[model samples]
Target chain A: MKKHIRKTAVLSILTTVALVLSYVEAILPPIWAAVPGIKIGLPNIIIIFILYKTGLKDAITVSVIRLFLVALLFGNAMTLLYSAAGAILSIALMTLCKKINLFSMVGVSIVGGVAHNLGQILVAMAIFETSQIGYYMLVLAVTGTIAGVFVGIAASIILKRFEKIKI
Target chain B: MKNNNSQKNQKLRNDIILAVVIVFIAAAGLLLFVLTKQEGSTVAVKIDGVVTDTYPLSENREVSIKTGENDENINILTIKDGKASISEADCPDKICVETRAVSFVGETIVCLPHKIVIEITNEKTDDQIDVAV
Candidate 1:
């Protein structure tokens, strides 16, 4: 019963956090003038923290749930599809890199960020049915790397406390 | 598990390498973009993936695009000196207004919330046609 309560509490708190981050980002003004798709990706910090504290299964669950919730509440069908692709790809890369354990939190997040931008570009290409949008990827990658490093730092700091409170 | 100094050094090196590679990739991508951009004089305004209007870059004009669904929605695109840009938009984000005027082929200004796109199309030049014809 204790374990059940802990899991539920953690899940709900993380979900709420993820939602708040999404809401804040939506309302915030555009950060990068050159790249419209670029976002600070604050939600990824929560996703990464959860991944580090728990495991891949729980992490994926949280991410997918977060994506759908944000989509339904604040986005359209196309944006939903685009964001879903980015989330899945980022999570998958983060999981694989985390398993390897060769790099630090920052390095892992750098990979995740690059993969996230790639996933979004792939979806954009599919939606427009054109390869002309390739140049935009570079802009996205630059912004993603910057945002990822910030998130990685935040995640690392938060994960340090999880060790003491491990269930 | 206690990691020794060597492990720390290795991890640091890995992070450096990763960061360097991404920077290199971004630089290359930027160079490719600058080199591959084409000049186009035709601009097409599209909504919901369909073209709603087409304009020439050479003419200076103000075109106000209205969404059929929301009558109040308005995005004013302006063209001048062979370039086009969104001078004003009533959308929430107003990101389209931030984008610089574009004269190159395949360049675009997108308002995601509005589902609007303005893309430049290449115009035919007389030098390409055969003299015999």
Candidate 2:
């Protein structure tokens, strides 16, 4: 019971952190006005950390909760659809990479980032019903990779510091 | 200690490999799109996945496209000097407005919230009509 409580408390705190990071990302001005939907994916740091320290189930639970809350507060149905697709695909791929244990935390994060962008582009293509916008994926891939590297580095640092503490 | 050091090096190598692979895939996809591109002679406006209008790229003009159930949504498309762009839009994101002018075939400016797609096409009206006839 005590262990369970500790786990619950940690997850709730992490969920709140993810929510706050997402809010900060939403408020920040577009990194490049010319490019739409470009985000640093700040919330992903918490996601990666949870995946490494806790497990896949907890990470996904926090991810879905954060997505729903963020959408309800700051977005609409359309935004929710796009983000849900991205989040699902990203977490799946990230889990696969972590399970393989071949790459470091940074690598897993990069895969997650790239997968997230690809999922969103696929959703856009389906909605527009035109392959003409496919080129936009290339631009996004570059940005996503850069953002992933940063998020991965940050997650690794956090994981190292948290190792000394029990919970 | 030596064994642990080598294991760390192996993981680092794997990370570099993953990064390289993603970069290669992105580059290849970009090249494919570039090779398939050609200068378009007409601009096609699609709403709800249907072609609603077409304008010659040579003619300079501004067209206001209104959407939504009550015609509340608006996106202004401008064609000048053989290039087409969305100069204004009332959509929430304004992504279409920020997209640069497109003159090549298959290039598009899409407004997801409004379900608007402006694409450049190489098809001439005469060819389209000839095929239809």
DockQ of each two-chain model: 0.56, 0.71
**TM-scores of the candidates in the order shown:** 0.87, 0.94
Which predicted model would earn the best lDDT? 2
What would the per-residue lDDT of candidate 1 be over residues A106-126, giving only the tens digit for each residue? 888888887888898898777
* lDDT, candidate 2, B1-133, per-residue tens: 9998898889889998988888888899899888977899999999988899999999999999999999999999999999999999999888799889999988888888899999999778559899999
What total of clashing residue pairs does each candidate reach?
A: 0, 0
lDDT of 2 by residue, A27-141 (tens): 9989887667777889999999999998899999999999999999999898898999999999999999988889998889989998898888888888888887777778788
Q: What is the lDDT of residue B105 in candidate 1?
A: 90
- The TM-score of chain B in candidate 2 is 0.86
Instruction: Assess candidate 2 and give its lDDT.
Output: 0.91
Off by over 4 Å in 1: B1-3, B50-53, B69-73, B125-133
Looking at model 1, how many pairs of residues clash? 0
Candidate with maximal TM-score:
2
RMSD of 1: 2.8
lDDT for B72 (candidate 1): 76
lDDT of 1 by residue, B1-133 (tens): 3578789688878887887888789999798878998889689898877887888888899999987575678999999998999999989778889889999998888876677888998644433465435
